[model samples]
Target: MFCRDSESFALFLFSTDPRLIQTATQSGVGGVVVDWESIGKAERQVGFDTQINHDTVEDLARVRAATRARVLCRLNAFGPTTQAEIEAAIDNGADELLLPMVRSANEVETVLAWVNGRCDLGILIETEAAVERSGELARLPISRVYVGLHDLAIERKTANPFQAIADGTVERLRAAFEVPFGFAGLTLPDRGFPIPCRLLMAEMARLRCDFTFLRRSFHRDTFNLDLRYAIARIRRAMREAFARSTAELEVEHRRLLEAIATADGYFRARCEMNRTDAVQAASQ
Candidate 1:
């Protein structure tokens, strides 16, 4: 249901707009992530710029009626109100529940108690604690593990979040879990930042990544193009990447690793320079 096979696909839709869900579903994405995690007042107080969507149930039902794409509801952090939220999502027709900022396997156990195998379970490996305890977490009954690059970068204060993929964090998780594992965020085919799009795709294919989300960049860049066409283009590129001989794939992976190191260095230097500039301005 979550595309555990070789082909990976997903699109993130923050709003409950019917037209948007219809477009994403018809565009060939296998599933849609309905983000309800950002709406909580507690999350907002922490300075997260999460859009509030009040019509999660309505939107999920609409998407289910409109297309065959699986609907995943990402709930806010586990807490006193988690059971209510989890029940609501399940009743509203969500095929899966994704928990964010999880730090321990005990958290997963608690959630599974509520879930009881009604729907698949997923967790975002965004914090250092999650990364460190990944081995223990992987032993649980999770449908998949997605590496949250944006949040992880903020948590680790890394210049480049992609550096984790290059530095073996992802590899370690992959080894720890038999279920599908995914890292990296996807934009439009031509809009890769800090790394080239092709290189990123190659690395995902090499890692045997099961899925990724089409986020802000995809929506912005594909404004003029047909959504199906854009999705097809990326799928095609990844197919081509995986089609290469093992030797060729290895050579390309090495090249991409080198590129990652270079990008990390650039980001670190730029961040340091900006800090220096800020200090100078403050003094003057």
Candidate 2:
């Protein structure tokens, strides 16, 4: 699943736990995705500092206890924080661990090794190289692969949202993985801004993508979006986005075809002129 920054997820948990279970229950979010690596720095070399008081771990556990929502952790990829993050996620009973910036089969192996056969794992394919190796990724014990559209688009030089989808990346991913993957089409730099939830749900349905991370920009009355509105907004945005993307793809295809035709015509004219020169030389 697509896990955005962890700080926001932490804030969401802190604000809603304990006395707000009823409110949180009504919010309809799947769960908060935390970056365990970013949650709190360890004061000691071996573990976190006890002197500095922050009930982050306790709070998270309480939130978990209080809400029906899942707690997913996004760990630092192969960084110093990975171990600590994994430990914290396990201790806090996080439902999933989102491994960020995976580059190779080996990286996936490394994460699996660290998990030591515990906890669910998800991955973010955010690089061109990662896309190239997506097949290997899908074969791993990952729960899901989230389409990191912004990074993928940047790497492919397809800045347009419509072009990005039609660039054959997402399609290729679906074809390759053949499993329901998550998508991040609602974030900044992506045209699916504000996450029309209805579109997100629809696109997810169309692509058979398992999940689409909610666009952080979709405002909520409380710390998070109401699940209903979030889902609706995402679904709506995806449908509109798909339509816009289709139109854009058609235009681009037409433009490219025209350019190719013009090039062919130019080449034929040049060849004809050359033939005329040959005829004149033969007459002489």
Candidate 3:
């Protein structure tokens, strides 16, 4: 079972390619997220495409046979086919089920009724509605809650998806839930993203996050490095960051907050400009 602790764990997306699963297992990641949710028509219609987009039931079975690492299946949101999808995932050997775009405590309850302790249950917090009702949602019996940066950002129309991390949204969830919670995806050290990979890891450590999803950026950046080495390096950095003195951590935290504020301001300005342009176009 995934538990909240000082030690953090990484979960990489599982692919249909057996080699990828073999590599991730050998690479020291805690688990692989089999993304059935992302490949669904609903998600694809919204432009969520990746190199790998098909169901991986057979691949998931192979992953179970090939690796000791945990296998987490991300099922589609509560919908017409939800029960069937959940059953298929379990039949294919998912150790846990991750439900995405969850909106209400009732939804969690409904899923829980279906799950009935077959495996661990995880939910993605990705809507403004979800955030507002997080306190109620957190009270449900679930293993973990992962903050979905992309969806939440789109829903909130924020400039930076990672603003939630610096804006205290995640902190509020942490206070409400005893189960492990995580926000933001991670990449390799060389990927200079909106938030520096190291800084993100440091912040996650400081927040005592139990786990995070390793995104495509990790695969691209660590192409040359051995997977295990890359994973170990990140784990080490997070541990060291967490072990830093309180004063040093505080300074880094302040710096990260400032960066987030700047990004948010930039986004807001751009949105205002777009609105102004639309108004002028309509008038003319």
Candidate 4:
């Protein structure tokens, strides 16, 4: 297994099922995420197509015992339970702690103080404020950074959650950090919605992304198929990205941004139509 900072394309699978974890580890996954970062997410993402996981510290221990692969635990934002959460995650054998929805440099620093080098650390950039202060976060000894596309879209109230990838927000953050960087997820190379996974891989290659979580779409797409073959296709696509020339890279990126913008327009129109319907129903 490569180190977290290695240039290899690390694929993380989010699951608490030991059977799935065993399969994923056997098939060359970088880590299995036991996500516990669900505080206030439901209210914040209301009316949005998002689901929150209520994974517990026990799940961490379960997954830890299930595989020799790395286990990354994503803790909720800073709050009363943060210290206890950090302690529990470490005690349960988390190889790394990913602090999500952070709002300040102090929050990152606080996690660092609490962890005290017990394990590796990472952060999810999910807010505008966090993006502004990310350069500061990167200077610290964090393991990696993954941009939380869904939460960031909700925070900014954008029609398209992928607007950051289209608008260079992710790239700017990537430029600031010397550590490994990634955003979005990968399923099959021939699959993905709104933005095809192939196009997204081109962008990842363009940005030199070091890691990505395998999205839920991947699970559904690969359930009956060979997991190793699916992962190989993804890795092969990432390599093919580098073979494209500068002009080719820009053209592929422009096509991706155009697709996202088109989706954004449709989403806005649908929201507007829904508002009109609501008004008509109220006045009737």
The most accurate candidate by TM-score is 4
Per-model CA lDDT versus the true structure:
0.74, 0.54, 0.74, 0.84
Model with the higher TM-score, candidate 2 or 3:
3
What lDDT tens digits, residue by residue, belong to model 3 across residues 191-237?
64456777776677667777888877777888888877887777777
Candidate 1 local accuracy as lDDT? 0.74
Candidate 3's displacement at residue 17, Å, is 3.1
Cα lDDT of model 1 by residue, 104-132, tens digit: 88999999999999999999898889999
TM-scores for the candidates? 0.83, 0.60, 0.84, 0.90
Enumerate residue pairs that collide in model 4.
none
Off by over 4 Å in 4: 1-7, 269-284
- For candidate 2, the per-residue lDDT at 51 reads 20
> Candidate 4's residue-wise lDDT over 168-257, tens digit each?
899899888878788999899899877788888888777777898999889899988887778777767777876677789889999999
Alpha carbon lDDT of residue 100, candidate 3? 85
Instruction: Decide which is better by TM-score, 1 or 3.
Output: 3
Tens digits of per-residue lDDT for model 2, 1-284: 32222112211221334554445335444465544433332311111101222335665576667766767666765676677767887888877788866688887888788888788888888777788898788788777677766545445543332333545577678766744476643332223322323343344434545555544443332245454554444344444534445455455444533443444444345435655665687699
| Most lDDT-accurate candidate | 4
lDDT of 3 at 137: 90
